[model samples]
Target: MALHNKIGKIGEDIAVKYLRQEGYYIIERNYRNKFGEIDIIAAKNNYTIFIEVKSRSSENYIELAQSLYYKQIAHLRRAAIFYFSEKNIHLSLIRFDLIALKIDPAARRIDKLKHFKNIID
Candidate 1:
């Protein structure tokens, strides 16, 4: 795979591990539809979460938090609605989460992982 793709996959793996450790039950990864793609779908307590994972190496950490745009958020919301309907899930306690990670694939380490809950709404 291309270097960026490899890094993305590694970052996703790290996000999954972190989510699991935090007691989120992973329902899916890379969930997609005509609207867009959701990186992770998980359930915790009373919420169904649609997560967008953004990762960068230490060299690019400064660019991490600003990656998501309003247009992308709209797409995610549309896709999430489709996902809920297809899965027969209710929208009552749904949330959108953004997990930004600073990772070092060469060292197999995550320098930082920040979770922003309900980021879209």
Candidate 2:
């Protein structure tokens, strides 16, 4: 895979790990439909979280989180709506999140990981 794709996959893994650590049950990963794909779907304590992951090898060169543009956000929103409607979910609350990851291939470690909650409508 290309470096970016690899980084993104790593980011998704990290996000899943972190969410599980936080007591969130992973509902799905890479959930896809006609609209688009959601990187992660999690549920806990009556709340559902829809996550978008962005990863970069080196943020010193380019920030990873900034890659999620307006159009991307729009698609995510559309996908979330579709998911809720298709699942017939009527939950107490729902949230959107962005998981930003920076990986160091040389070190074989994560340089940084940031979770931004409520990132979308």
Candidate 3:
């Protein structure tokens, strides 16, 4: 894999581990459709969460927040709608999330992991 891909995969693995530790049941990873791709899907407390994982080696949390654009959000929402319909899940049971990770790939460490829940609104 390319270096960036490897880094992204590692960041995703870290995000999944953190979510599992926090009692979320992982349902899917890298979910894709005609609209776009959702990096993670998990269930917790009766909610099906569609997650977008963003990783950067040097940027801080503020930069990460700015990186999530309206266009990407729109794509995610459309993809999530498709996911919920195809999976027979109710719209009311869904949540949109963004997990931003500041990782040190060489050290295999996450300097920071920010979980932004219900980000669609």
User: Best TM-score goes to which candidate?
Assistant: 3
Residue 84, model 2, lDDT: 91
In order, candidate lDDTs are 0.87, 0.84, 0.90
Residue-by-residue lDDT tens digits, candidate 2, 53-93:
88778674236557789999899989999999999987769
Q: Which stretches of candidate 2 lie over 4 Å from their true place?
A: 60-62
Name the lDDT of candidate 3: 0.90
Question: Quick one: RMSD of model 3?
Answer: 1.1
**Candidate 1 residue-wise lDDT, 1-121, digit = tens:** 8877777888899999999999999999999898999999999998999999888775565466678888998999999999988888766998999888888878878888888888876
Tens digits of per-residue lDDT, candidate 3, 1-78, equal: 887898899999999999999999999999999999999999999998999998888889547866889999999999
> What TM-score does prediction 3 earn?
0.94
- Candidates sorted by TM-score, descending order? 3, 1, 2
The per-prediction tally of clashing pairs is: 0, 0, 0
Alpha-carbon RMSD to native, per candidate: 1.4, 2.0, 1.1
- Models 1 onward score TM values of 0.92, 0.89, 0.94
